[model samples]
Target chain A: MIVVLSGGVGGARFLQGVVQVVPQQQITVISNTGDDREFYGLHVSPDVDIVLYSLAGIVDAANGWGIRDDTYNTMQQLTRYGNEDWFLLGDRDLATHIHRTNLLRQGKTLSEVTDNLRIQLGLDLRVLPMSDQPIATHIQTPAGLLHFEEYLVKHRSADDVQDVVFVGASKAKPAPGVLDAIKQADAILIAPSNPIVSVGTILAVPGIHDALHEASGMVIAISPIVGGAPIKGPADKIMRGLGLEVSAIGVTRCYRDFLDVMIIDEQDAHLTREIEDLGIPVVVTDTIMRDDETKAALARTALQAAGLTI
Target chain B: MIVVLSGGVGGARFLQGVVQVVPQQQITVISNTGDDREFYGLHVSPDVDIVLYSLAGIVDAANGWGIRDDTYNTMQQLTRYGNEDWFLLGDRDLATHIHRTNLLRQGKTLSEVTDNLRIQLGLDLRVLPMSDQPIATHIQTPAGLLHFEEYLVKHRSADDVQDVVFVGASKAKPAPGVLDAIKQADAILIAPSNPIVSVGTILAVPGIHDALHEASGMVIAISPIVGGAPIKGPADKIMRGLGLEVSAIGVTRCYRDFLDVMIIDEQDAHLTREIEDLGIPVVVTDTIMRDDETKAALARTALQAAGLTI
Candidate 1:
């Protein structure tokens, strides 16, 4: 079985590749929940939905999140009612939050709700949330502690990030099957997701980091940084905010202890020996996933790196 | 001040006429909340919304409820996720529910939340819910006790109703200002709505019926029955199920206690004397409001009947 650690758009994009190389039923995804927030009082799991929409082949390819051709009629009306519409909830997208919120209010765990979504979406792959516990990834900014989305979406990430804190992760256990997926996987790939908040929050869950530390399979990571910057999102700003280098070297620093293989772009080839000096081997290739071909190629490389495809 | 007790579509249509004669700010609507139900976990106030949309001139005239031209993208997507979509929730209309639910969750009374909607919709009048307390009008059918919506909307009012019940009305207090509105009003108009579930549930609230009984205002009612049938909805079926006559006299029988005058359609003119025999004077007129002029004419007649206009 192949297990993937994911965040939002970037991870969803990389997952498009993973599903191409591996049979869907044999793969499992552990998604970040730190970015989950209530929009209009309905629970919205941004990262999880991104992965779900992407793998189900319904994600807006141009934007890389939300359903394709989704309508914003609800948001338009919400604005008319004087609600804050800065988060941009599409009408079709609102259904996901509604279903999730209803199930959660009915006392179902997040894991169970996610599985319910999986079955409903006709996806064969398993997608486990990082934890059932609510975790707010708060970005300490000049604007004060902003929820990650408020920092990225509402504020447009304009404020300088001062620090990042996973609010509830310290007490959170990994969601059911999360630890087991990592432990029994033939390959555990960390998708090209933001290291600081996305993957970082997942690792912060009490037993997850420890599980990876003793995993029987190889833990591979593809750096989100391409040519010294993220293809999308505020990864570079956040990495720099944490007083870390915004490069392949920095991503490795974040996951070095548990990582068996680190994949970097050809642009960061010179940093290979430097990354390897810490005893973690680095694989250099064209890691920027521009299309289906590039995404599949990257997935093939990650699998081959774990000796699953060789 | 003019106070009108209202239900859903029929009341909304009648209010269109009332607003033509009376300045919006001069009118107070006591809308029934017995039909309120949670659709997909969001609180949906059908009667309240019908009133809001109608007065705002955005109501779907054909359906007599919901905002005109509202999209159904949310409901479409919701059905895709396996949720029952029998009750149509237009995308724009959902914003009202979301906003209402959010405020209600934050501990705002339904009255306050409704006032918020009123102001947000740029309305000048007050639209008070029947009570701050929730009173579900359940239809006890051979099938079981069904939510008013489940009975009317989901089941298409197909089942034979054994009885109708206001589940929580016995303990429900009249909302703040409700008793005062009835006590101090110069005129009280009961819009054409279902007497059994709609107006019946309002009267069932503790103190409200008593307040109406002692009201100093000339309490007027427009019978929804015409030609021995209702203009819309299951009023005829439910009245028959309750073993009451489905005619103008039947409507007067339901409201004979507080009513000083009863307005019946020209088609039911023959029943006027029979209704007036109960000590309630009856006015016969064309009560089917087909257009703006007809609606205005009906409003003028009701006002003149209360000696409030020429």
Candidate 2:
């Protein structure tokens, strides 16, 4: 199994690329559920859904989230019913939430629901959450503690982050097969998702980090940060808030302990020496995934760096 | 306190009149939750939402359910996703399902979420579910068992009803305050809804019928059947399936145990003696709620019969 650790958006995009170049059945995605939140009583797993939709080839390319051509009529009516419209839930997206919620209410685990959804979407790949337990990522900002969605969606990630706390992570165990995916993997790829909130939040769960450290598979991470900026979202701003530089070197240090190979952008070729100085293999390529072809190319390049091109 | 036992459509219209006649806070609606179902995992309580929308004055006048001017864009997309679209769930309706499903996943009771919806919609009336548990009304047809929605919406009630069963009825407990609504009410008016599937299903829940039997309040029912046919839906057909007449007298017998008065349409005034023979008081009026004025007039008439018009 080729297990991939992912956040939302950028990570989902890279996973989509990986699925395109490789056999989907051979791939397994261990998604970060730390950003999960209960909105309007529905379990909204942004990263999990992003990876699912992206891998299913049904993600809205323009937004990098939500189903393609989905309507917002439901969200508009929700506002009329006096609901806060900070989180824009698309109508098609609502179906996924509804199905997941129903199964959960029936006492099924999140892992089971995730698997069923993948099957329903005709996906051959396995998409599992990091944990079935609720692990909420909370951003401690100057305004106060805010749910990750409130920070990312409602406030548009405008606040300065003082600290990031993953609630329930301490009590959370790795979901079934997550550790197995790590142990049996030929390679483990960490997607180019937001480092602090996505990848950092996943590592917050105790056993997941240890599993990565002990896994025999070659572990590689694609740089979400290019030269000194994220391709999308507030990763750059969040990095600065945490008193870290927004560069390939910063990304390398973040994954230094577990990372076997690091992939950076060709624009940041000058930083290769610094990245390699950390005693990790560094690969430089055009890491900006502008389209499906570019994403696939990036995926292929990252795999080659780990000596798994075949 | 004004207590209204309601279904959808006509029940919603009756509740609208009740809201206009009484102080909103004093009115409590014991809405049928037998129509509740998990369509793709969203908890959709059609009757409760209809009453809510009607009370909020946002109900679609044409369809008599969902929000006015709600689009079907989501429904159209659901088809693309290969979902069965026999039941019409508008985009606006999806929001309610999403919100309810999400809330339910977080361990909130159905009653609590419904109250929250009532508050959100600015409805001052207390809308209590008939039962908090999942008690679905299934019709055993020639084709086998079909859900209430499939029998009603999908097939348009064309199937020959061999028998009807309220699944989970034996296990269902009346929602909090449902029994209280019956006992404390000065009067109880059953709206002109499907006697079998709607009102019958609500009464099937344990403790509800017993409470009504012992209630001190004057129990009145507006006949859904008039002349030889139903005002709306296939109540007459269902009545026939139960080996009962498709007239006002048939409805009186169905509710005879606790029924104090039977309200019939002017067209069925001739059936008064036959109903009165059952020892239930009979009133003939324009029971067909053609407009808001007629509905309010019906509410006033029912209140006057119970000596609570003031």
Candidate 3:
């Protein structure tokens, strides 16, 4: 099994690349649930769905989230109900959340519900939540601590982060098969997701970081940050808030203890020596995957960095 | 205030009449919840939604249920997951169920959630579920006991029902304002709905029957059966399952104790003497409301039976 540690859009896009280079059944994704929230009573798993849609080849390439060509009739109606429409939920995407929420209400764990959705979406790769338990991400800002979604979506991530908290993570147990996938993997790749709230929150779940630390297989992570900024999202501002430089070297420092290899974009080739100084192997390549071909090529490079052929 | 006891399609149509005849704020509907079930963990309240759609004038006129022009794309996709599509939930209708299910999971009672939906739907009339508790109508057939929707929708009521069980009725409490509506009503009219499942289930709720029986206002019922058959739905077969004749006289006899007046179809005028013989006043008219004009005329006749002038 090739287990991938993932977040939302960035991670989902990278997982799409990985799938292109590997058999569906050979992959397992341990997704971050920190961005998950209950809106109007529906459980919204932003990261899991992004990955699911991306892997299924139905993600909106232009927006990098939601289904392609999905209508917004439901969201428009929800707005008529006086619902805040800052976070856009397409009609087709609403169905997935509805199904997930319904299953969760029936007492099915997130893992089981996700499995059902994957099967329904005709996806073969296993997508597992980092933990079955609720782990909400909160950002302490000038406006007070807001839920991660509120900061990222409702506020458009315009607020500066003062502090971050992974609520419920202290007691959350990893979802079933997550630890096993990491332990039995030929290699584990941390996708180019936001390190602070995405991959960081996944590692916060009890026994997960430990499992990676003790993994028998090689662990490689592509830097979400390239040169001195995030390729996408608010990772740079968030990293700066945490008093860290936004660069490949900074990303390597975060995962240095567990990651065996760190990959950086060719633009950050000058920082290769600094990343290698962390005592982790370095792989320099053009890591920005703009299309399917490039994504698969990046995936191949990451696997090769772990001493495996695609 | 005018309180109408209702079921689904026939009931929604009748509610359209009642709302047309009376001021919206003065109309309150106590909808049957016996057909309510958790479909995929969604608190599916078919009767409440029908009444809501009808009162809002957005009901699918052809089906007499669901939102007008609603699509079934989500339900069609649900089939790919091997889900049985016996319950035909339209995409727009699915949004309502999804929202309701999510709220219920968040610990909101059915009554509260229903009120929220009513307001959201822009319905002027008060649409209330008979009770917040589950009071499923189970049909005991030659094959086996089936849920009310399963028998009504899936099998199209083809199975011979041996018995009808209002499961949990004895333990269910009337929804908030239900008994109060009965007490404050100028008159209460039971619509031409399924006697066994709809009106029967409402009376089955612990204190509802007694409240209706003792109310100071006149209690009238429009017979679903005309001549010797139901104008719509399976009330005829269901009444027969309970060993009752499918006639206006039989309907009068079933409700004689609490009924002050019983409205029969013009075709059943010959049986008015028999119904009167049972000591219940009778008003014979065209009880089948096929259109807005007919529905409004039916409402006027029903009100006249209760000695109310429109």
Candidate 4:
């Protein structure tokens, strides 16, 4: 089995390619839950929903998030009720949150709810949250600490990040089957997602990072930064605020502890020697996924980097 | 102040007329809470919303419930998630439930949440739920006892109703202003609603009934039935199932204890003397409210029956 650590839109787009190269049954996704938050009392797992919608072929392709043809009637009404309309919640997308919230309230863990959603959406691949326990990613900014979503979505990530903290990481244990999927996998691929809030939060979970080191399978991560900038999101701004170089090398440093191969874009090939000097192998390639062909090709390169035959 | 005890569509329609006759500020709506239920963990007060939407002039006039131009995207999507779609929750109407649920979770009483909604909707009238505590109306059917919504909305009142029960009524207290509104009103008008579940549920609350009896104001009821049948809903079916006559006399009997006067449709003029024999005065009129003029006229008649000059 192939295990992929993923975040939101970028991670979801990357997985679309991975599915093309590998059979659905052979893949397992350990999705980031730090981006999860309660909206109007409904638990919304942004990252998990993006992956689910993308894989189910229901995601709005243009936005790389939410369901296609979704209506904003609920959001518009919420605005009329004097509610903050910073976070956009589409009508169809609300079903996922409502269902998940109801199940969670009924004593079902996040993993169980995700499994039920996967089955209902007709997905063959397993998708698991990093941890069943609630963990919020908060970005420490010059203004004040803001929930990761407030900084990213509400404030449009305009705030300068001083530090990032995973609120419940210390007490949160990996969800059932998360560590097992990492250990039993033939290879592990980390999608090109925001390193600090997405992949970083997953690694912060105590047993997960240790399991990545002890696993027999090779671990390869596709860098989110291309040509010293994130393909999407505020990865560059956050990395810079945290005093890290905004390059593939900076991303490599974040996961260098357990990550075996670092996949960098051809634009950053010049930094190969610099990344390799950190004791991690560098696989330089064209990592910008513009279409299905390119996404599938990038997935193939990451699989090869993991020592997989196909 | 004029206090109107209400149910859903019928009550809401009657309220529209009441507003036309009396200034909005002088009206207090005591809406039934027994029809309230949680859908996907969101508290949905069907009766309360109807009254709010109607009074705010945003109710779907065609259906007599929900907001105008509301979409069912949320319900359709929930169906895709394997949720029972019998309860049709409109996307725009969901905002009220979402907001109310969030506040209730925060330890705010339903009365407080309702007040917020009323003010946000720009409504000058006071809309109070019958009670702040959880109370559900259940229909004891031949098949089994079902929640009022299930019996009405889901099954379309297909089951034979043996009796109607107000679950949690014993412990439930009237909302902060409910009893006071009833006691302090110049007149208490029972809207043309389902007597068995709508107005009946409100009267089931212990203190509210006593307040109506102890109050010096006249208590008047408008017959929901015309001739031998209700104009809308399954009032006749449920009334007959519970071994009550499906006519104006049956409605008069329901409120006869505290009801000082009743206004019946001209079609039921023959039964006026019979209702009067039960020690209550009767006013027969054209009660079919097809337009604003008719609704206002009906409201004026009820007000006049309570010895009001207008």
Listed in order, the DockQ scores are 0.86, 0.47, 0.37, 0.87
For candidate 4, the iRMS in Å is: 0.7
The digit string of per-residue lDDT tens for model 3 on A6-56 reads 998889888878988899999999999999997766789999989888877
Candidate 2 residue runs with Cα over 4 Å from true position: A142-144, A183-186, A204-217, A241-243, B17-27, B72-86, B101-113, B131-147, B159-187, B201-219, B257-260, B303-310
Worst 10 residues of 1 chain A by lDDT: A301-310
True contacts kept of 4: 0.87
User: Which 10 residues in a row give candidate 4 chain A its minimum summed lDDT?
Assistant: A75-84
List, residue by residue over B1-310, the lDDT tens digit for candidate 4: 9999999998888888998889998999999999999998999999999989988889998988899999999989889889998888899998899989988999999999999999999999999999999999999988899999999888998998888989999998999988888888999999999998998899889888788889888999999999898999999988898788999899988988899999999999999889899898999999999999999999999999998986
Alpha-carbon lDDT of model 1: 0.91
Q: What local lDDT does model 4 show for residue A154?
A: 84
lDDT of 1 by residue, A212-292 (tens): 999999999999998789888999999999999999899999999899999999999999999999789999999988899
1 or 4, greater by DockQ: 4
Best by lDDT: 4
- Interface RMSD of every candidate? 0.8, 2.9, 2.4, 0.7
Decide which is better by DockQ, 3 or 4: 4
Please tell me how candidate 1 rates in CAPRI terms: high
User: B20-130, model 2: which lDDT tens digit per residue?
Assistant: 677887888888888889776678999999998888888888898888888787676556555678878888888888778767777989999999899988878899998
Judged by DockQ cut-offs, is candidate 2 incorrect, acceptable, medium or high? Answer: acceptable
Best-first order by lDDT? 4, 1, 3, 2
Q: Counting only residues 3 or more apart in sequence or on different chains, how many pairs clash (N, Cα, C under 3 Å) in candidate 4?
A: 0
Model 1, position B96, has a per-residue lDDT of 92
lDDT of 2 by residue, A214-243 (tens): 989999998899879998888888888888
